[model samples]
Target chain A: MNKKYNLAVVGTNFIVPRFIDAAERSGYFHLHSIVSRKTQSGLCFRSANGYDSDVVIHENIADMLNDDKVDVVYLASPNAIHFPQAAACIKAGKHVIVEKPMTSNTRELLSLIALAKANNVLLMDAMKSLLCPNFSILVDNLSRVGRIRQCTSTYSKISSRYQGYLDGNNPNTFNRMLSNGSVMDLGVYCIHPFVHLFGSPEQVHAYADLLDSGVDAAGIVILKYPQFHVNITHSKTCATTNSSEIQGEDGTIVIDNISTLTSLKFVDKKGEETEISAPQDPNSIFYIAQHLGETISSGLKESAVNTHALSTKVLTVLDEVRRQTGVRFPADDR
Target chain B: MNKKYNLAVVGTNFIVPRFIDAAERSGYFHLHSIVSRKTQSGLCFRSANGYDSDVVIHENIADMLNDDKVDVVYLASPNAIHFPQAAACIKAGKHVIVEKPMTSNTRELLSLIALAKANNVLLMDAMKSLLCPNFSILVDNLSRVGRIRQCTSTYSKISSRYQGYLDGNNPNTFNRMLSNGSVMDLGVYCIHPFVHLFGSPEQVHAYADLLDSGVDAAGIVILKYPQFHVNITHSKTCATTNSSEIQGEDGTIVIDNISTLTSLKFVDKKGEETEISAPQDPNSIFYIAQHLGETISSGLKESAVNTHALSTKVLTVLDEVRRQTGVRFPADDR
Candidate 1:
């Protein structure tokens, strides 16, 4: 607690500033710098996040890394650039936090993890759900349902940018080059909690509604295990009841929302329902940032929560989904 | 309305009595005879369904077929015997109503339809969902959801007999010899409406959790259409919220129960929700019986609602599901 880690954030996407805010509020991190592709964007991101005159601004990763004060680099850039940027930070011996879907494919993710290990820097995926306390509550209550029979995790919501894509405009969300399809953007949330709770499945069967741009508008990915089946339903072009469920022989667990573990309950065979308390904290990133700061202080080389192995399995499922559905990405296999 | 057709009812399963009551209530059919493998069971079913002493009880299909007064034969027998039994009735010039999942596989269904055509008799599947007033209400409101993007229909319920099977007893529900399983017993309800509303998809990807008895306990079938995707999620090992949903570019239609369709509503992008009126009738067979009686009275050889084409498509999807999941049946390919 006596020593605060200096943090520098890249990318001015909406999530970046919010992550920085949470990181600073955790009190283990001081926002030392802001990095952006353009000078004005860096300033805008700085002021929008309420950074005063003392916060340094850098136009490039090289400039930020050259000044060694940034003890941890948070890469929240577009998916295509995540690997290269995270690699640069790890090579510079700075602890790294790569945003959800740490890389476009398994190969890239594994390569980045190897690089982080070679450099002895703490590397982790900013998959917040597992790091949050509510997720633990859900996992802990899994035994009440008896033997698992099947589970379904759905994270389908109409994206704000979909209207533009329909109106003859190209949105990054529907673009294959950015690796921002429904599965990558929303389905990863489904895959993580699913794989984390029940390890990797024995097989995967997947299908997606491909946009003209070759990215999935929506999709269903079924994971097959020896004892049960898990269905991960994700979409960007539509909205649904969007609750995730775990079905068992004796009862069922219903999760109100997936990305944010808002509230969960168990309904036994006799139809008795008990609500399990879960924080409705709108900011999932705050939990991830706190966990990341603690890990950095603890001097770990990788996150024990969002382990490299968990991220690998999640991206492995994503890889199979894109393979089956033909949602190709530029960063795939690179 | 004055001419009540003599209806011969087969199968003593729980759904059989409900169907008989509905058929009699429709006022277009009079219970003439009851058929079962056992004489006491046939008499028991006849008395339990309120059939008078004058209503004859037969212990075999041939005796029921031989009764010249039997105007129509309703086959609710085990799935494996549906095709053979329906063929016997159609050949005897009796109008026929085959229960949901008219046959074990697509091939058997097609063969029975062709035989019915040659015999010049009315033959139809009693897929009650398409025949119900609530289903019509749902179809009428489909346009309110805008251009469809994805749809998911789930029909999952733990069977009452599941406990007996789990306790080292081989219940008929989990038996492959009788062509009984979760997908056949429950998932057919999910697929019938999905195929009816959206037609057959261009491709299919299916998976199931197979029991030691070589039948599915739970499964998912993904139907891929050019414009959208339809997921037919079904189970019998567990229970779920079990709602059906249609996602469109602008809105979504949510059906509370798929088979019975207790209620439905449309929720638009603006979060404005409108409830669609649908009868909460537990007896879906009532609608099917009323429609079947009307169709037979109209002298139609096939149901205009649960058309030959719809049944063919539905059975085809079920076939693929069983094939993919390795849940084979004694009635398959016959």
Candidate 2:
């Protein structure tokens, strides 16, 4: 139980509180600092989340990276800023954990991976679902289902800020300039698990309902594999059943809440039900933080579970889906 | 009620028994004749359904169509035989009810509509789902949900005979030569209701897992409209949840089985449930039979509920999906 790393978190959005909670729960990582553009809001957020009064608070990335005590930086900034922010952390010799979508495009992600290797610092995508203990249980039970035939995953919830957008507000989640859209914001949850379960698809096809803001409000992506096919539907404009199903020749697996993966049920041909449950922390970020801490302690440059290769494959597929659906972001030009 | 129209059935497949039962329940249609390549199977089918012994049995379509007493013909033949058989019945001045995926392509369906008009005989595509009394209730309750945002319909069931195909027996349901595939055989149930609920989509995009038989074993079609989007997924290789959902700004409508539409539940944003139930006849085909008989008695050349126009629209979308998926039929050349 060598829990002795100093971790700093970037971004003050809704995810900052969860990341702080994850760090505190890991028991191996200390919340050494936080970087936010508004120092007042940063101080308020730190106190609200019960961070120690002595925790360093910085208003910019440079100031936080200069802190020699910070060994790991968890980046949860906007989509367009992920590459530059993570590159800066790695260049400063700090391990990094990025949010769901590592970067806006595959080229940026590839370059970041190269830079991390050059700097000899670990770079990992904080895809919490893959890091959960239950996900390994699912992977272990895949053989019981026999030959896979089809998979359908859906993640849709009407955004609370959607009404504001409809009333003519420019929220970051719906802004193309920020590299934000339904695919990047919501569909990433589906793509990560898909890539983790099955490797890169042979072909990718997608269709979307693009909003006037130049971002997709809803979309469906079809991933064609050699033996099986996957269909992922996601939206920010409406809520759905939010259930995922994988059908095989001998049995089927039904997963509720693919993002959290709280419940899994397997049904065989004889209609026998088997419930597989695992330890689920109230805060999902705790699992990813624990895994990241352990991997860093062992001197690993990437996660064995949320592998760099898997993140790259997911980003590549998402890039293609965005291109096919005409969801262009400012970062795409670069 | 006329209760006197003479009805003739073509094809001795499993659906013929259901058509016989529906006619018996309609009370307006009498089973006067049956057409089959082998009259022995037709006799057995008639006897199994308890049809009167005096019912005429014909070995050819011409003989049944020429019978002056036959007022309507129900063509339940394979996918490729629908157009020619329905056209012949129309030319013989008998009303016709053709099973779904009425023909292999839209061109044949359009020609049938025109011929039925010229002959002054009622022509209809027997899509029982559209004619179900519960369907009308759903249509009437659409406004309660507010402006529509998205709809998802799935009708996937592993065909009972799929094992035969897997074992190297080419059943008609899985045979490309007979113009039979998952989309044509099972997807029509989803497409028909989609068109009935929302008119023809502006664009249709599809991806499929084509079997070695040159037909799709499973596939998904995305229908894009101006205000809303629809996703229809159908498969013959496996069974699914078999549910349909329509999401709107204020509420959602869910149907247990889109094919039979036995249960409908509406949920609002406040988590209130409204169970809307309608008259659900045990025999679904009875609704279509009753509608067709009444429309013909009124001297209408097409059904208002299952209109020739609506049928053509659905087939046109189906044709586009087939073209995208490369599920070609011999009749497609014509």
Clashing pairs in 1: none
* Model 1, C-alpha of A30: deviation from truth (Å): 2.2
DockQ of candidate 1 is: 0.68
lDDT of 2 by residue, A1-334 (tens): 6857998999988888888778777887888898989999889988887889988889999999999999999999998999999999999999999997999999999999999999999999998898777787888888877667778888877787788888899888899998998889988898889887778989998888888999998888888898778888888887676378787766767787788888887877555778885768878788988888889999999999888899999999999999899998888897
The estimated TM-scores of all candidates read 0.95, 0.94
Single out the weakest 10-residue window by summed lDDT for candidate 1 chain B.
B276-285
Clash count, predicted structure 1: 0
Give one digit per residue, the lDDT tens place, for model 1 in B194-236: 8887688787778888888888988888888878888877888
For candidate 2, what is the interface RMSD?
1.8
Kindly report the docking quality category of candidate 2: acceptable
True contacts kept of each: 0.66, 0.26
Which regions of candidate 1 are displaced past 4 Å?
Answer: none
All DockQ scores: 0.68, 0.45
